[model samples]
Target: MTDVRSELVADPVGEPREVAPTTRDVTGLDELVVRCTACPRLVAWREEVARVKRAAFRAETYWGRPVPGFGPPDAALAVVGLAPAAHGANRTGRMFTGDRSGDVLYRAMYDVGLASQPAVTGPGDGMRLHGARITAPVRCAPPANKPTPAERDTCRPWMARELALLRPTLRVVLALGGFGWQAVLPVLDEEVWQVPRPRPKFGHRAHAVLPATDGGPDLHLLGSYHVSQQNTFTGKLTPAMLREVLHQAKDLAGLS
Candidate 1:
């Protein structure tokens, strides 16, 4: 069998922090993201997980590289999550794919007409997001689903550039989990909107509207508990609750 890691493209010349700012569009930024090897720890962990096959996925080849955002370039709404999952996105090469958390997230998105399918089994599963994109603060799946502060900082530039490129039509951002909410504030403040003093706190259904630095329409920021198993299995984040937030975000984004 061929080594999956060998099939991955060599890392680009510069680091993510340096290259991300120079990227002009989402496509270029995504290409850089997939080629990133900036975080040594994350690189080792993701590749390690991909090698040590999960029992159910033992026969499958894993996509150990960083996963890029999923959806259209001109999406009006964006969903931000903490990071890719080790057994999930790390294996499938798509955010929120092949996991229980994704099961809940895509279902809610589909219910609100943001997704073409209700669930994703893997990449090329015919799933599509309509007028909405899903991304994360960290592209690679971190160990124990927790990325170190350093890793998060190193990965921030990619998302910063993504939001900057999306600023033309992107209106509302739905952040899943407190980590994602906190991580996105600086991206908004530095790239497009001027975040308020004593930055907005995060909670399920919490909302904040940030005025644009360039005098454009305001961007709405919405928060929700992550669709992790701990939250969903415990009913902390229910289907009804998630759909409600999606509906409000869609309205704010003017995506009917």
Candidate 2:
């Protein structure tokens, strides 16, 4: 099978500290993640979300702006989630921003020493991350927070481009849920991933050892149930479980 959506890897560039603010690294999906207007329906939904949430939580105004992938400028670990949460990253622009999901993620990141701050309100909230980054399969907010398969496919290339930037040092990836892993696995080396498991079943804490390709870095990809309210409130994903995953990630990256 085709690997990691190879179509866009042709002209992949070096990991630059400064990407164009208005445009993403490439003119492909990465670029589109920042400027895409294909899903008008979701855009409208995001706007409404921002408006109401902004009014209610005036102090914590929703980001409601273009959600940008985040991490230390040169992080090695990239955590991929399904999509932006409506009141979270979709509004705040930063992955996992503005809501409970982010609260859990940032807390976990902090507990395991990955986050610069314990909570994320928006991009300007003065928080930062180290040795790790976070992104999603889709950049835009989807209706009812679900991206259609075509939408996810359209957004995959940008993620690939982002992954390309970490090139030599991207030692590990933590896929938040099944979809996030499925979207990313193909573009990477097969040996990097453990054999695929049945779909719809999330493998929390599982890990795959990936050898470098084309002289790229070796990688360790781990799995985690998304720390969404669904998982957290239901007690499927706990703070300790999430922290343990981060601890594994740090160990894998030799970050300690």
Candidate 3:
């Protein structure tokens, strides 16, 4: 695993209060995100969870820091999630890994040909995604899986930069929940696409299209219920339902 500190760059001047503008390429930005401690609450909670490892993972080392987006830079689709899970990404160092939520998501993606594996045990587990990238609105795991509005706003610049870097090839965005749906709108506005005057509401299969700037291309946005236990366990979101959404997104993105 890479050392987050060793990959850090000196703090740049005139950057936003919390989220810094990306001065390097996507790879550099990934490293930069893992080193961020913009929100004191998130930093404290993530570290606390790592230090007090769950009984099952007591013998395992935790990533503890911010989890960066994963997948190819040229991906045509992006799956945006909420914050990391305390015992999940906060422990595994990869978003949507080492948890039930990730289990459901990866399985669906793999079935739809977006992922090479149906499960990811850790960062180096050799699981990969094709034509799609996985990321979150907030990089760090928040307390009780919830981040305050101020924390979300403070962390906006990173998501903004990540989306900007992916803009060239990105054609579709799959927001896993309302939180992610809301998070992406403003970020997209700052990038190549602009949200409508009255934002589209989030719902299962909710769809919206924003024409690219200067007649570049049209971007599609879709929504789905988060793959949390609350949704999956209660049948609010099922495997078939999720797979349907993913298949549609893959087709829309024109992935083979």
Q: Which of the numbered candidates is closest to the native, going by highest TM-score?
A: 1
Q: Global CA lDDT of candidate 1, please?
A: 0.90
Question: Model 1 over residues 1-256: C-alpha lDDT tens digits?
Answer: 1122323547443577788889888998888889887787788888889989699999999999999999999999999999999999999999999889999999999999999988789877899899999999999999899999988998999898998899999999999999999999998998869898889999999999999979888999999999999999999999999999999999999998
Clashes of each: 0, 10, 0
User: What would the TM-scores of all predictions be?
Assistant: 0.96, 0.79, 0.92
* Pick by TM-score: 2 or 3, better one: 3
Q: Local error of candidate 1 at 254, Å?
A: 0.3
Per-residue error (Å), model 1, residue 93 = 0.5
Cα lDDT of model 2 by residue, 104-187, tens digit: 999999888888878777767888888888887777678787888877765565676677666656788889988887877865
By lDDT, who's the top model here?
Answer: 1
> Where's the lowest-lDDT run of ten residues in candidate 3?
1-10
Candidate 2: how many backbone clashes?
10
TM-score of model 3 vs. true structure? 0.92
| RMSD, one per candidate, in order | 3.1, 7.4, 3.8
Question: Which residue pairs of candidate 1 clash?
Answer: none
**What digit string (tens of lDDT, one per residue) describes model 3 on residues 40-112?**
7787788888889899999998888888898998889999999999999989988899999999999999999
